[model samples]
Target chain A: MTGERTVGERTIGEQVVGEQVAGGGSGTDDFYGRLRAYEGRAAVAGGEGRDAVNEPMIRHWCEAMGDTNPAYPASAPPTMLQVWTMGGLSGHTGGSIRSEAYDELLALLDGAGCTSVVATDCEQEYLRPLRPGDRVTFDAVIESVSPRKTTKLGSGHFVTTRMDIRAGGELVGKHRFRILKYAPARRSSAAKERTTEVKEARRPRPVINRDNAGFWAGVAEHRLLIQRCTDCGTLRFPWLPGCGACGCLEWETVEASGAGTVFSYVVMHHPPFPAFDPPYAVGLIELAEGVRMISNITGVPYDKVRIGMPVELEFLRVDADLELPVFRGAVA
Target chain B: MTVRVGDELPPLRIPITRTLIVSGAIASRDYQDVHHDAEAAKEKGSPDIFMNILTTNGLVGRYITDHFGPHVRLQKVAIRLGAPNYPGDEMVLTGQVTAVTDGTAEVSVTGRNGIGNHVMGKVTLRLSLDFPHGEADSPQRGAR
Candidate 1:
């Protein structure tokens, strides 16, 4: 997959990870390498300007990321949706240069002799809600570069990239990503310190029970559904045994518009659980029915989804019995 | 139409202190001294080294957990970062209930640096709608 680049006649939805000849270029060893690199980034960046995110792309992202939120109104994750906007961040060029931007960046930093590169920190500020069918423009810049530090990965550099996500000149989100590039540390103090401070894994493993069986089924169908208490007329999520108010034991499922607003959230630099990636976002979204559910936010660019902004839901299939639910703003 | 869509939670203000930053760092496994070592941060060109983005995000998640109690399960949170907040910079964490269903709810979350928005994001939580609290009523163990 690294050398060939001609847009082969591979059928749609086919998982192709090999090499293909590109346009009329001689398959020189080094030439093909550079060309593949160039083609890779170009495809990722895509053609810039309006219409950056299309329905098919969104669906593909949602499927790959296993994000399920109603905002996608599909079985996908909002976080994966942000990748579409990142493509626009490459600018409005349909040329191979624009496509090669992300890879080039990786190659540039890698070529710069940074030992081991890893993501140390990330902060995504959602300025506005990102909705499906919205064309967004984005620009990313290297905001800062920190000196190398000793760690298990060795001495590394911290590079921060700031991406401003926008749609029709309106600010959507501000995403700041901090990447660490380091070499193996030889028993350095920094390595010991980081190792000592490592957080114990605590994954959020909600059990799959009968109460939530229906909700999981909805996910299989790409639907967002909730349950309500029949006795106290209360609403619940993750399908529970009793009412939150009247202590009622009976409940019924309800399908929602999957819209809500930011009640509160935090940026977690630590990995509370092994399943969760570091620099993760944890938040509480208040539904219109006076209910609050804990879920991850995804879809829109990091900088575009913000507090008090509107959002919707999307469901991601984690397994046959479990589906992860993610959220994004309903309107951007 | 008198139909329920989502519900709002009580607003909360969290003190953005050195301790808060420390707890988040510990929870996130982020050992950057800038988050804990004020002196080291100053040496690194930071104005007293503010909380890491990971800590900021964890705080947001904690806010929801605190309000909803332990019965509710957090599914996802999408947040962003803004101006660097030092130990002294207080943050106002807020939320809004935008949509609701029988068992699930969606909320938007925001964290501000005293003056303006420092972190903006959203979350979706799941809970038992029938009972006053879900079967899992016990609060989760505090982050180590």
Candidate 2:
């Protein structure tokens, strides 16, 4: 009860404030020591940003995530999009955060008396589309920090970071992430406390039948190609084995004009994918060939992409040999 | 008989479910726990949700495209998401045929979540309309 104490007699707040005010009282700055320790102990996690949109990675990311939307015409086995975007697609792939960084961050939070940490929200805005064959530099910066209160978990701090993804001297995407950390709640003496581990769920490989073999193959080559049914002459995308309308098995592989108009779109304030930062727009675009492609609309402010707006395609590499196709409003 | 301007287009019922949600997520490469994990979602801040807006839009667009047939090209679709759509919620995609010309038609579309409008927007179609009007069918050869 002497200084700022939350848990019984262990006063971390008092210690922190005391150290800050005392200046030179404590033996060697524990803040720096603690920071170094955290750097060594925190969990390392990262998100992937494309220098230029790589179509193969976009398709692979979707495939890994088991996306079956007809808009993405990639050919590949479904993996996990969240993991891929979170810089987890490869054990040690490109543009991923070192796990040591997570360990360090956790250590820092723990020293601050925060025991439980979880990713709460994410938002990303694309300035330019990511493409294949472009070497991109990933820059992650802590944007803001705030303390929050939760009924179930007492009190904690929220850390937000703005990740600026750049490729070829152009800003490709701006990723914003919010992480929540809480102090283990101190309950009544008589009540037994319940604690559980927050685990990242595992995803299984998507079952790829003959329906989408060609699409996946094109992804390996960083291509955004679709199938035009030889029978009905209808251009169908997201690669089904046969035509959706005519049920024709025979088809010709055609490249997308990659040009479309935004039919409509909605800005997502919530994180729908574990790998994604939130505040994005899921858009429906009617391609030049009369096919519709569903993708995340990037490069413009979420509120600015309007109905009947022109857009162009950009490829993203989800991982090696895998690509994803996303879209942006075509600038007039 | 042609649909009158402002006449309500026939309401199309779309089954909102988890599978569709997953499909849309996969297509857009947005696989978050809140979308696929029921328990994880409850832990976050959801009431056992169903589909994300991307999937919802996909369904709505599919409904119109299916109705319009292959020849009529879909020119545009503009929509907005209002309420959270849970699985099993009957999504009644309703619209009004706002405009129809000799070679095209425009429809205002909306997805209702029973309680209220979940998604609202518009769609435009450019029709070949069999053949171009007032133009001769034969290609004119260069004058000798």
For each candidate, how many residue pairs have backbone atoms clashing (under 3 Å)?
123, 52
Candidate lDDT (C-alpha), each:
0.55, 0.55
On the 0 to 100 scale, the lDDT of residue A277 in model 1 is 55
Question: In model 2, which runs have C-alpha deviations exceeding 4 angstroms?
Answer: A1-93, A96-332, B1-4, B131-144
**Candidate with best TM-score:** 2
Tens digits of per-residue lDDT, candidate 1, B64-101, equal: 66666544555555554545566777777778665454
Residue A71 error, candidate 1, Å? 29
Q: Residues B1-144, candidate 2, lDDT per residue (tens digit)?
A: 243456576777766677656655555445566677887665544556456544554455555655555445555444444455677777788777656665556677767776566666556566556723222221221210
Please state the error at residue A126 of candidate 2 in Å.
19
DockQ of predictions, in order shown: 0.02, 0.01
